[model samples]
Target: MPRLPYLSGVAAATAVVALLAAAPPPSGEVTVSRPRVVAHFDFAQGQTPENIALEPDGSADLTFSAARQIAHVTKQGHTRIRATLPAEANPRTPVVGDDIVLGIARAHDGTLYVTYATGTRKTGVWRVAPGGAPRQIAQLPSNGLPNAIGLDERRGVLYVADSVLGTVWSVPQQGGTPTEWAKDTALDPVPGSEGGFGVGANGLKVHDGAVWVSNSDRGTLLRIPVRRNGSAGPIETRATGLGGIDDFAFTGRGDTVLAAMFLDNELALVRPDGTHTVVLTQEDGLSNPTSVAVRHRTVYVTSGAFFTMRDPNLLLADLGERHDR
Candidate 1:
């Protein structure tokens, strides 16, 4: 939920240099047209869209982080709240942050799953079936900040990213107790984080038979293969040096992906071999983008504006004729 790390100049430069291999060649090396604004938001009203779940009907269901609400954005650029989560009088969520909704995933049956971080016991995974009310399906560790949630339909389970705990948890598709699916130093926050929440494993995805994660604090992307017996396979650091990376979506072009770099206010196309290209920037209406979702030839990005405190909007970029999936 936090953006803009206040790292020292030298350390920041080093981090950027280290990620050069995963970055676009140069500013002019890639030419991405400015994305068109799909819908503007009122940050003061807490309508900052944090995560997205695209539906088959060409609409998107989103989690409004600070608003404690789920909304729907239509193809015509219209939007409305689909579900409103419980508001707290006092939020105790870790890292001195307010109670908020972060990552979200949609099921085939129109069910929506979301990750909520409240300092209280209500902190966990919640599900809403179309028009039904939000129900707690799984109770995760309240000590950590659960940021992203991914549902593996093939495995019939859910994978959660705990940014603070540096762990990935798995819960039954039917909703139950969560078990530790994977944990390692690669998922932990860096040592000298003096700004933001010092988050790790911020974004998550279950694709190509693997659980992919982004470590915001460490600036690394990881992939953990799912074993046949439902166990976590060896961990692989696929990409690195992407500081402030929040959430990403695979372009369906094998391992290619689009990542939202929160601190840099940019979006990057991370290739299969670890190199990347900056496809969009603040000039394209990105203001601390938090998450991305790709559907066919369109790229959907959510600008949370947590740092700028300005326009929190959604931008849509067309990848020309290149199909996403």
Candidate 2:
């Protein structure tokens, strides 16, 4: 773990932008009263980050599509390439989307699970073990396209949200056929906007006993209750009106759900009451943020330039930055 002096979170936030102005390369960590830009990367010109996950030990893993790679960012700010996902294996799956990762998660045993789809071969899921090569874990039916991945640490099950198929399927964490947990055709893409199945849902996380799914096109966060048998309850919409929700994570011990709105590039906090607070806005310098994770009161958001047209960079905000308290 990279150790930096623990300044008051406030002090760290205030110094970040000032420090950025004085530097050539971005300094890795930024501390603020609450919101600080701890790390920033310029998406290698063409490539952009899709998702970001903080390792239990405090390091971060980021996935980039245009660059065809995944990188591990140390707590101290150093980034090292971890893997080059075989985009060459299949072309159907996007290289990256709105900074949403190819899908990165850690199993209970600290094994990293990364999932990406190829446009060519839509039936397969890739499993890459730590210090090992990538292997094909399962090949689904012809029409199945695996989008986002989530892990049920206790049960050793992996949840896949396939927007293309309008379904959420759970596979054994070790790898196998996926059982449908929930599905809604309403989420496919609208006829004019982007075009697709209408529902743009993916980016899944298992919290408490429920699997929270981000419906990007409909702009809502859903909680699919996972029973003991791993089947699901009626799909419950947890919060709505988020602009194009993509992916999100729990914050501060998992009390609040911090969701990233892909269209608006906003980070919205969903309280238990189903109400939301706009924690970060594009005006705060976020553009197409796809995934969000909270570590020790700090919110780490990853965003892409959006396709080949937008500016791609990762934004770190100290959650307390805007709080005067």
Candidate 3:
């Protein structure tokens, strides 16, 4: 028998909650049948919200470089100042490009991991305690430039996508040497184009014993089975032709995945069978989206005016019952 994709429904609610907290609530208040725009925030005007991470409690957290701060946005739209990166962490590291926290991951114990790259000169991982300061975990090897970070809730492994070498490394969440778990070539079939090799792995996640990566250059999503010991199995392609694909998130539904296509200016809803359709397109409110997160049926996205810039926007998308479709 073929592998079955996970589907979201009332029956899966428990699993969804156990897997991912509410993280962020739907931007819209009223419930609808299909996905719709709920709330919008523009960073270009100084509201700088960079990478977003959702908690199981329906709350959202955003990293802001302008104020050198991290904020927690509640389900009710209330924003709180969580903590500020000390000048010493030097979030403004010359090489880190003003955007150190390009990716964020939270473990089941509530430990938060942030990835930073500073101008090919220096780059390291930071682990944020529940109520303590962010401490350096491990420095990226000279050949590695951390672009994306993902957590394996089951094995206590942290997955980092290196843009410099287009490879993925599995590091112990507790901190230690990392191993090459998988590569982007899994999705790229053409010679010199395996999963757009050499283009850098931009986004990644390990779900249900499988690893998924965003090959932004090739506009494809790559998946491969992951071993508990941090080894990787054969690779496979999940979805493709996603113009300017930036990031992806599961809708708590097994077979469903939502992808953010920056260039296309739309959110592509994908099924496990490799079929997808645009469920939400850029309307009057969204502009240059770069990341996505889902809570319940609500989808939260971060938009920016330019890539690798301090300017960004926070746009909420309501998936409602359409998630069932």
TM-scores for every candidate against the unseen true structure: 0.90, 0.78, 0.75
Candidate 2's C-alpha runs over 4 A off are 1-33, 42-46, 93-101, 141-145, 193-199, 253-255, 307-311, 320-325
Sorting all predicted structures by TM-score, with the top scorer first, yields 1, 2, 3
Question: Tens digits of per-residue lDDT for model 1 on 199-273?
Answer: 888999998989999998888899999999999999999998688899999887788889999777889888788
Which ranges in model 3 have alpha carbons more than 4 Å from their true place? 1-50, 65-69, 84-99, 120-122, 184-199, 307-311, 322-325
- Clash number for each model: 2, 35, 15
Best by TM-score: 1
Write the candidate numbers in order of decreasing lDDT.
1, 2, 3
* Candidate 2 lDDT, 1-325, residue by residue in tens: 0001231232224222111123221232222224444556664543467777678877787777456467887656677788775545334443222212266777655577765555444345566677876676765444544556788778888887776666787778778776776777534433323422243666788888988887765667788888877778888877776646778888654446787765555677676667665656667767667788778866778776462234665666665423222
Which is superior by TM-score, 1 or 2?
1
| Tens digits of per-residue lDDT for model 3, 161-253 | 775566777778888776776765543222232322233466676677787887765667888787655588777777766645666888776
